[model samples]
Target chain A: MKSQGGDPDEELVVRVGRGDPAAIQALMARKLPRMLQLARRMLDDAIEAEDVTQELFLRAWKQAPSWQPGVARFDTWLHRVAVNLCYDRLRRRRETLMAEPPEQADLGPAPDRGLQARDTGRRVEAALAALPDRQREAVVLCHYQELSNIDAAALMSVSVEALESLLSRARRALRAALADMRE
Target chain B: MGMMDRTRFEALAEAFGGRIDLWPDAEREAAWRFVAEQGETARALLADAASLDEQLQELRPPQPSAALRQAILDAAPRLRAGRSRLWRWLTGAGLGAGLAAACAAGVLAGAVSTGPSADATADALMAASDDGAALGPVESLGSVDTESNS
Candidate 1:
């Protein structure tokens, strides 16, 4: 609903790519928080998710100097990094169906909010994590990442058609997974 | 339109992409055109499709982690170190190799000087000449009595 990763953001990315530290800070100020949130959703573990976010930003800083335009959006690249890292962690899991972080690591407590939005948010997070990896990434990019379909498709390295399919399956899976939870 | 199978419905679902909610003008016009002329069958399909789009939008993602903000920031230094360390090691290795090559050259030079080669032979000849007696005949030959006989 709001403007995100738009033209001005692209200019920031281009500046950062030119070896500007201030640009890095600016980029962090804008993108880091959202990147962290997205990573958390994908990884389902706050600490690891944060690591992914940091890694993603660090990569952007390192890669900024040589970034080329017309390939994809900067935010798309960041989301791709976050999602790919999640998949890597998922594949490396041993003796665990999911990444069950200890309760101590529970991202502290959530901010106080209305029960409906908060509960819906919680169920949504769990449902997202429960999804098969790709579907989760697809849905996260579509809904939470708030990327355009074309950009999301580019990030996923798939055609628009393929992305459509991914989103479709993802939505269906989410609906099925959260069936018991009343939205 | 009448009774598309699950696969066709899934295809429609994928194509629609919940665009019904957004109502992009061209797409809406196209959908309208298709639904307008067609019988009740097409209308029914469009209606079902619209409902599906609403359902898709209802599935929401949650708020990210509480510590997630901190976690990402904390990792920045480590990531920086990772990138910087690589260049540091490369530079250090390059300097080390250069020093190693210089030491190797010094050792080779030392060996050559101490070696029993033609240089030692030349040194021996120079020492004989230094004593002056070894060059006595040759030196006098330049000032021989041939000048007095002429």
Candidate 2:
């Protein structure tokens, strides 16, 4: 679904369509980091994330020239593309690794438990990585990407109630997985 | 806005975390009102959820590498001079042949009119031809329909 109005990226996108060098550079500066982070969190693989980022830009360059404003915000469109690319890669991984079980978060107590910031961070990332795709996506979009719940729901093609349910379940699992950290 | 009950407030806290700002727009005011009425109780309800939110905050987003930035910037589409129908036709009919045809036309026009000398006309045509040559790659890139997946 398209955004209502006041898309901040609209002018830059139109300039990009015209192959404006300054606009392209500006857009990269603004969007690359966000897209990269999104891909990294979604895939949990840095190399694959970079690949997805490259592919996302290639599509953006193609879409720019023909882009129609108000149909959908440029940022929303880019997120959709990035999300779909991640899904494709995830699907491929599942197909090839069908015999292997999905990685589970190590919820067991750690022997050398250091509640250092870095260790806590790693544990959180692991917990996130261990979530099912839909739950992880819901958390990433609403929490990490900071997209509005409505926008995230539309992106996931789920109702807002369904999105809320996913978020609740994801948070519950994460809280359980990292329960040891709180103590 | 309806008054937020304890059950509803707890549910929102679970879904959106402890921060009222993260709650859905429709629910935030009511949620805040509930907090105002039952401060410590509301805070207690959100404490666990807030702890998880804090843990999630530990994983900062990674910065993009310089190499990836350079690669994507290098592949960006470049600006080219506008391609009119006549110019499109010229380029469509092979660059060398197109320049030759344009040069011949320029010579004929120069000979017939009281304009610049044929040498000057040919020089101008050659310059335009060189410009088009410089933009060939950009033009080709623009013409490609990426939707085909070829």
Q: How high is the CA lDDT of each candidate model?
A: 0.55, 0.79
> Which one wins on TM-score?
2
TM-score, model 1 to reference: 0.52
What's the DockQ for every one of the candidates?
Answer: 0.05, 0.30
Over 4 Å off in model 1, which ranges? Answer: A1-8, A18-22, A69-72, A94-118, A180-183, B1-29, B32-150
Task: Tell me each candidate's i-RMS in Å.
Answer: 25.4, 6.7
- Misplaced by over 4 Å in model 2 are A99-118, B82-150
Residue-level lDDT of model 1, residues B88-119, one tens digit each, is 23334554544544654564465567768867
lDDT at position A72, candidate 2 = 87
* DockQ of candidate 2 against the true complex: 0.30
RMSD of each: 22.4, 8.8
Q: Kindly list the per-residue Cα lDDT of model 1 for residues A56-90, writing each as its tens digit.
A: 77677667666776565666677777778777776
